[model samples]
Target: MVTTNKEKDLYKKLSIQVSLNGLSFCILNRKDNKICYFKKVDFEKQLDPIKVLSKIELLYEQEEQLNQPVDEVALLFNNALFSLVPENLFDEDNAASYLKFNTRILKTDFIAFDKIGQDTVNVYIPYANITNYFFDRYGEFEYRHSLSVLIESFLSLPKETDTPKVYLHVHKNYYELVIIENGKLVFANSFEYDTKEDFLYYLLFTAEQSKLDPEKFELILLGKINKNSEEYKMAWEYIKNISFMGPFHPFTFEETAKPKEELSEYLLIKSL
Candidate 1:
């Protein structure tokens, strides 16, 4: 646990998760892996590069201890962000060099998500799917993979011993749906979709191929969909027994220290 001058806190660590989709920053505690502060900065403003960096610095400046040498800095950026930079080519080397600290860019691995449960499908992006063209050269493939792995590892299953399970994952432009029966992967696939209807059609197609009773499998949806969101509504309309990517018992962690109303999406980093 890393304590700070603000008061003795439990953990001390910093991690930055940036996606081509958007930028997500988190100041975490290494002790319990609890996030102390987190915020997502959208690119809607089209700020200058210096301004972007300045915003990052300000974000870190908020923490008293964060001013010192940072132990690690992990970033996930879209590849295109660097394509236009002429001064410094923003490849993996440049991204690492730009961060300029003891940092490691995590590696993304395509692993079957279904290896964990029955009635559960395992999902993942196959390595063949990665393209240097679409994923900016400065992209963080490994970071995304690491985060997904962390979520999967952190979520526990006790009551789900005898049922089948499914694993789903979100990637650059595709979603993977997998089927697991009795702790083994049976069917797996990745498909691209442009609309919600497109996604639902694929889901129905995959479900038909699995040939299992829909009622036998618990539908686990991950990524970004709220209960009342259209995504969730569509999924539930199809499966009816849908559940979010649960992290077992997440409410136990009150480390964000914020009121429930102010909780950020970083909590979704864990599968729960």
Candidate 2:
């Protein structure tokens, strides 16, 4: 097929990040290098995949932007059902086995994997029903575990120091902890928490296990946290050098569609 100038001018991309707790999406106009639309919806409580799909369907029916055709679609599944394996040690045929010991999976669950950089493989379970719905609607689309996108985005950053740096991507009830040293990923994991104390415990524990001193290592915050958030306050009590992840993207945002926090939707925007 030959490409046309008109088609090229209409180039746009949609990237969505979905989890049991909520869903967020953004539409980017590639020609202008701008994000024209962005929205996030949080559920009152955690929902199953079926319920989440229904919410997504309703959003598409109600939101004019979501109904518009786009040149590309990328869906990211964010959940705790993931495990990272070294690239050399990963086996495609036994993907399930790699996650079995860490994540609970049934025989009927669908498994998927995303190779990150040259050294890591992220193995996880995506919502089959959600994937099928997207296929029926968009024909062909790209999908990956949210952690894969997160890790890739972080790795793309320039290495500033040899000392290990800790990154925390906070969600509603859970958060992802990632440590990097000399521009390479050293540790990554997710933890569920109900209170600020639980969050602090996990953060400190992970820092200890990584042999990083809380008072010395730099901690960068991303996602749903802020200076006033309880999670931030608890972390500040121990960690000395803590800062929120800065605006690392160059894309312009539509004034009306801009997110309140620059670091909000770090993964969704980067996935584009």
Candidate 3:
């Protein structure tokens, strides 16, 4: 990211994705539904989102024009409890127990689903006070767990061709491994890995547990990985049909003028 002392253009709508170790912001023109600017700031071994948010608030305060008349800011968390309970059998009050977490710590459990065509009710925990602070004047904003949105993404698109397909969304030092068979989620788990071996172990282990053959199955990788990266190379060595999923926006993803450094964050914003 370029260091700029200049004030930013006040976007009408914005999307922000915050994980344990990073933050990304995309400002948009509401009328055209086009991106104006994107900025990503990654933290090192820090987990407090509140500290990261304070820095964002400082920018808003310093640039008054960028703060006023902002219509909506959608905040999605990378870390959250993901649940896919059958609609009829789901209990709103007992959502925490399903994830084996205390209700007190994760106070706000929001139930969300695709309005048009969805079978299950996916519940996620979003921060209450920090989220509230974002829209103190307006009193409300859109929210989604990172994983929950991905489930909706699969639902809204063309069905997978393979019987057991894996989508590995790699983050800083961790990744979300999911097994989808014909648009049905069979397994969803996140694993923390510090090396290529660690990543491969969790991936193959998940596939083995899910009864998916490595050779027969398709593994589509998303987030932070590239052809030259060790993780990608190691994956290609072991997995047969491994492929990288990149930015599906303004320009179709092809090796272009510059390295698509922020494409992963762009994908998340596109998911919004």
TM-score of each: 0.52, 0.95, 0.80
- Per-residue lDDT of candidate 3, residues 70-133 (tens digit): 5566777777445556667677666665555522334444434322135566655565545666
When summed lDDT is taken over every stretch of 10 residues in candidate 3, the lowest stretch is 251-260
lDDT of 1 by residue, 217-264 (tens): 777766544576565577777685677664432333335533242223
Model 2 lDDT tens row, 146-227:
8898888888888888878888999887899988888899999999999999999999988888889877899999988998
Could you arrange the candidates by lDDT from highest to lowest?
Answer: 2, 3, 1
Worst 10 residues of 1 by lDDT: 78-87
What is the clash count of model 3? 0
lDDT score for residue 11 of model 2: 76
For model 3, the stretches where C-alpha displacement exceeds 4 angstroms are: 1-11, 62-68, 101-117, 250-259
Report the C-alpha displacement of residue 175, candidate 3, in angstroms: 1.0
**What C-alpha lDDT, on a 0 to 100 scale, does residue 154 get in candidate 3?**
52
* Candidate 3 residue 28 C-alpha distance from true site, Å: 2.1
Model-by-model lDDT, in order? Answer: 0.45, 0.88, 0.65
Better by TM-score, candidate 3 or 2: 2
Separately for all candidates shown, the number of backbone clashes (residues 3 or more apart, or on different chains) is: 21, 0, 0
Clashing pairs in 3: none
